[model samples]
Target: MGGMIIVEEGALRIVGGLVDGRPVAIVQEADDVLFRVSGNSIEDAVAVARARLGAGGGVPSQRAPVDVPVDAAAPTPSVPPRDLRALLRAAVAAFDPLRSEGVTEGPGKDRYRKIYVAGWPALVHYEFLPSHARRHMGVELHVETEKAAAVTGILPALCAVVRDAMPGQAVVHDPNWVGGCGRLQVVFPDTATADTLARAMQQLIVLTRPRVEAALH
Candidate 1:
């Protein structure tokens, strides 16, 4: 017969049958020998165990019961990890608008909003300082575009929009163009500021960004 154990949400348990005259539970799922375990009640458990006994399941008997703690009390995270590597990778992957041209790179920690205009530098880094504990702060936008209009026109337009939406500071095109993997990042003073700035940018960029030409029929 199969064994029964009470478990919570994260409880790991014995999920195998007797093998080699000893109880054998797996640490994780086993490929070929998985179907052999189908026990619930005294009757069903034994039946499932026996069905796979002679088929291919070896006679090994070393089942280990795992105790996975219940996660009902643990709070789910609202924010992603601050690790720059993972953050940059995620940003690149999710840069849906840039599906075709130009690659996405780094959460390069910058003291101020760093811009890349012409060619990439050997090293480019930036930082994001969140304003969670602080009452007020500002967000600086960093960006790049194949069109010169983005540097002169688009980014300037974005600054005006942000000012209108929120009390924003000065917006200037960085004369020092430090390039890299071809993506731009705007660092906000805090999480809240970042979110708001991104939202505003998205609204404006959607309408203004050069539309992708439709495929020929």
Candidate 2:
């Protein structure tokens, strides 16, 4: 069993097992292990721990006792640090429409990846800004199609639909965006947490998909 270390909305815990005989601490949001760190001592592990807000929501105020297993017979399974694609995967999983419709991830380079549902006119993308910290990434919905009619005719209406649904959001209609592929998207704040970003993308997908389908018909 894991014992609480940082007891708040996004919780971290020291698992019972050790890695290479070193204590391990992990940031777990429900079943998904968002991050992991290990060091010679418990304090070392905690010092380097960085995590996203857990899906579980909140944690108990009290810190539970950590029961580190005495047996060093075998090491715990190592959880590699999460990358951009992993973050996108979490965001996709948070939304039922994306998960149910089945999204595909295109080959990504550096800090960007393209994700889309089968037969959908719009594609979801996440890109990390060089000026911003790693957590401060940008998520966008691009209306990509070979037909000029879709870009010239349908994009403005789609942008209006999204802006109407998400008032106060800085939704934009960029005809020249992404080399004139054009898109309607809102960039999330740099300060937004992982959970917040995921929720924002989920909201966009739910609001935009119907209008996109309506246009296609």
Leading candidate by TM-score: 2
Alpha-carbon lDDT, every model: 0.30, 0.47
Residue-level lDDT tens digits of model 2 in 1-217 = 3322332232433332243345665654432346676765554555445322332334432454343221111122343333545555454445434343555555454545555656654443322221123223455666455453443456676666765776444444566765666665554433334565566666666766665556556
Best by lDDT: 2
TM-score of candidate 1 versus the correct structure, residues matched by position: 0.26
Model 1 per-residue lDDT tens digits across residues 1-217: 2222211112221233323223333321211123334433433444344444441254443433232122101111333324333333333334335322332333444322221212333132221223222211222333333333324334444444543443222122232343411222232322222334434335323332332111000
Q: How well does candidate 1 score on lDDT at residue 169?
A: 25
The TM-scores of all predictions, comma-separated, are 0.26, 0.46
The segments of candidate 2 whose C-alpha lies over 4 angstroms from its true place after superposition are 1-98, 121-136
Worst lDDT 10-window in candidate 1: 67-76
RMSD of each: 21.7, 14.7
